[model samples]
Target: MDFQLIFLSVPLIFIAYKLFNRLRFKLPPGPRPLPVFGNLYDIKPVLVRCFTEWSQQYGPIFSVYLGSHLNVVVNNAALAKEVLKDNDQQLANRNRTKTIEKFSKNGMDLIWSDYGPHYVKVRKLCTLELFSAKRLDALRPIREDEVTSMVESIFKDCSAPENKGKALMLREYLGMMAFLHITRLTFGKRFMNNEGIIDGQGQELKGILNDAIKLGTKKSLAEYLPWFRFLFKAENEALAEHDSRADHFTKKIMEEHTIARKKTGDTKNHFVDALLTLQKQYDLSQDTIIGLLWDMISAGMDTTTITVEWAMAELVRNPRVQKKIQEELDQVVGTERLMTESDISNLPYLQCVIKECFRMHPPTPLMLPHKANANVKIGGYDIPKGATVSVNVWALARDPAVWKDPLEFRPERFFEMDVDMKGTDYRLLPFGSGRRICPGAQLAINLVTSMVGHMLHNFTWTPPAGVRVEDIDMMEQPGTVTYMKTPLEAVPTPRLAAHLFRRVAVGNV
Candidate 1:
């Protein structure tokens, strides 16, 4: 009888708390949340789409309750600027979910850390040392070598007698290139051989990384319902296990780098080496260094690949766009040699194509959730302290009000308007805006541009034999990064000299 009474009183208490806050604050209008659960059932698997749908009904700036948590979603350029620019400092903190808390080690890393001195210090380190233009320029050969290796791999596959004219899985090649490039940049070595086979350590790291992603993405009821925490014992155990495994690999790598650095008396340009060399200088802790290293890996690994894959999908779907880019490539970088990163500036059409791809399919549709450090008013709506804010970049890109023929996949639109995606322009915020904008935005752009330019300049992409160009899938798979729903498969016919497809040696840059 006593237990039943306590159980019944819980809902009553929850309702009263919600009501008191509702009366005290002028919260933005939203769907009527049910007691206790608070719109938990209303949210869909694809969260960005659900938010956009609700925005259309409740207006651009609306509220949603994810189990008593007040979430404010902004769906247009104006609201975006308000949240990301005008109120950036007040809302610069990250909203840590159960998974994020586990993955980020309670905000020790750059991406997940709260806005504070630690965040400021790490951001400075990244800007002045890690992601500085000088450092990125020093790492150019790794980028070029990996891209060329991809071209060589693809050429071999397409040139084979049995595989001739057949659809090749572009994701495999692209994924490998992304993996190799990131690992090399971070660790100063490749985990896989030239034949694309993972070494022992590579296999172990790959398994741990895959498990981390799965565990990180898994939805925990405990996150939304605090009373249900005891039910997720196994989930917590899994996260802890992931943490242990990640620490093992990271520490092992650190040890190896430390020994090598002492022997050589010189630090390599790779992230691991840089972190070790700067560890004492920056007053970094072991946890912080590990966190920052994995932060770079987690942030950089898949984003470039996703962007390039989406761009290629569009290029395949629109042959005219493909032809125009190839024409520009030919004009700027002729058939005598492959396109290099230097030629990216001259190939204006390629840049436009990439920008259009970004506008249409920003790799991360929803910017990372920002937590309010203080009570703020955005778009005349009261955002209470601790409220989580999300900017729907996807919705903003597709809004008919902001873009003319927003649904059309035309690269030519960029030619008409000069929109900057590096945080200055609110309308095309692929990398977000203000203080929390991606630090690696330039590096990502350069790699993506180089990869796409080379692919188009080296080969002509088309849908498989039976698949029509129009029938190619453009739907996005739901995750933090919006990957293609159907992994892209295309037929490539070499457009350059065979020798141009050979892999280039990446001498020390």
Candidate 2:
């Protein structure tokens, strides 16, 4: 090797020796890692599945390294509760990564932010303005209105002259509807055209945010080693292009709203208006307002879309469960013109369906990484300050000790148990737990339930032509939020003609 190469290699080798020898960690059980890159290779093929398998061998608590980053995986429900709730104050902080920080509009957004005064303020604002019961009720009409349009759109697409009566792409339709409603709530205006077609504005926004999310979630080589920054230049370019589009998207909304507020001078009601008021009161930057709004859109759209799709997928796979849920809906709702949040309590089976979806296909299998503020003891194992911690929510939800037939999707499990999505019940933490738990939980659940319930009530679903129930691709793809590699495409036929399909397929109640 050349002199310069030898000189550089010597320090790297020495540092690797030092990290291996001097950096002592009394961590929980996990696969042994290499000199620099830790258990990253092991997690490459279906991370949640691999982690669950490891938990079976390593016990509830374990540690793994992603290069220099430390990840502590909690597999047991009890310890998960302890870390996410009882000791939340100590564990509320998030690890700031170059990619995530850049993705969060330079950290003005709360989801990627460390727990602090700013994050606290944003969380309180969201809870009071967007998630409050009154706000949710006011938005019920928005959902009803949107779902009606969605149903009509589906009818049009499926019955089109050229379609030959083929089934529509139900998953994409649901995702777009969810995005539009959430966008309206966040910005007080619709991003799509009058006919619900995504306008140019909508496409620009979605394209950018989707690309940014994809890049931000990807495991970059540079993320593991700071010195290897050049490796991700292409990703960085793509990220910047998408970030610019998102910036333009948010800016357009802000400009229009600012002009409207100037004319009306009333700022009493909207979520963004409230934030603008806070910006003045708290001496915050205008960028913070723009940043936070974009934060809500990005965070809300992906997870909600995935949940709706997965719920539908499960419903298609299990006809008995589908029928049971519809029976509950019929009994509770009974040809109701519209469904609302108030209907949730009366339809326990429907709630169970949503709960079971959360358990089986959580949007984020491993929640956003949390950082230890100080040295801590977890399940009798020592974790040093600054280690990146990940609670294996996927593994915990499917743990045999916590749920019967953990691998199966059974809503009855919730009926038999009191597990809840709130931070308190560690057994079912789809939206996560503690301070970092999804601020949009209430809004998200309401949206998911309303959309899924109405769609099922209106039509019955079946696997597409030549696709068998057993042949459905349950295989998941790798991402921060795990999703089916293939979208679930099914023929949605009206339930009134159920007997017509008796020879062909069955749908879950």
Candidate 3:
């Protein structure tokens, strides 16, 4: 009888605590949460779309509960500024999930590190050393070479008589270029050749990346119900295996680099060489170095592909936009030569198109969840300490109140207003804002701009035969990174001089 009473009292006390907190704080308006489960069951898989729908009813600033965890979502530009700027430091912490903790090695890396001295040190390394303009300029040849290789491959496929007039998988070439470009930049060698044949080392790296994605997407009940984590041993084991594989692969590459450095007595231009060279100076741990290197691969590689693929899809769907870009490309960079990174500045329309793509289809629609370091007020509502805060970037970009004809795919909109995407402007934040804005924004911009410029300058993209421009689907796949629901395929007719389609060999650094 006493035991039964104790169990009943425990639940009663828990209920009272929850009620007291609710009455004490003026939380933002949101759908009523259920006991224990909260709003977890109500959420759709596509988080951005669901959040946007909720924001319509609850207003710009609202709250929701994912299980026991409270999440405050800010939807519009004004609230975005409040959370990202006004309360930047208080809300600068990262809300790490089980997978994120494993992959980031519990905040040993730059992306997932909590706000503090360690974060400050790593961020400084990134800004001052890893992604400096001088380094990017030195690596320009790799970027140009990869783009040219892609152009050469596409030209061959399109010009082949057997494949004439057939639609080509644009993602295939773009993915290859992104993969090779990132591998070379980080590891100092191309793991795969142009023929899509990968070496043994490439295979290991590819497997590790694929497994990492799988682990990230695979849901774990333990993530939501912390008390039940002890029962979910399988998920933890899988993450452990994934981490081990990554460590093995990265360490082997490091060993090879160390040996080569000793023989040559000179450091290479890749990230691995740089990190090893600067490791002692920065007092970075081995785990931190590995984490930073993988951070670059995971963050840099897929995002570049996703952006260019979206840009190409938009260009194919809008012939007028594509033609306009081509005209600009031809004017700035004639058909006699291939468009280079140096000529990107001369083409204003292309810049507008890239900006428009970022606005319409941001690579990460919901910027990685930001955590409130302390109880704070945003938009006059309480954001409790330790609450997960997210900015619905998708909704912010599509707000009709902010953008004119927000649904339309128009690059010319950027021409009317000069908006800075590098964190300053609240209206457009593809790279996010404040202290946590992506450090590699400039590198991503250069690569995307270069890839799009070359593709448009070399060929005209159109929907497959029998498929009208209106029929191309623009629906998004739901994930941390937004990809087109349907992989983009378009027919390419070569527009450049045949001789210019040849790939130029670039020296490996």
Which is the leading candidate under lDDT? 3
Q: List, residue by residue over 115-203, the lDDT tens digit for candidate 2.
A: 88988887777777657887677666676666666766665666566864465666678777777766776777666665556777777
Candidate 1 structure quality by residue, lDDT tens digits, 302-346? 888899899999999999999999889998888998778888888
What Cα-based lDDT does every candidate model obtain? 0.89, 0.75, 0.90
Residue by residue across 346-421, what tens digits does model 3's lDDT show?
9999999999999988999989899999999999998989999999888999999999999888999999999888
RMSD of each: 1.4, 5.2, 2.0
Error of 1 at 375 (Å): 0.5
Model 3, residue 126: displacement in angstroms?
0.4
Q: Which has the better TM-score: candidate 2, or candidate 3?
A: 3
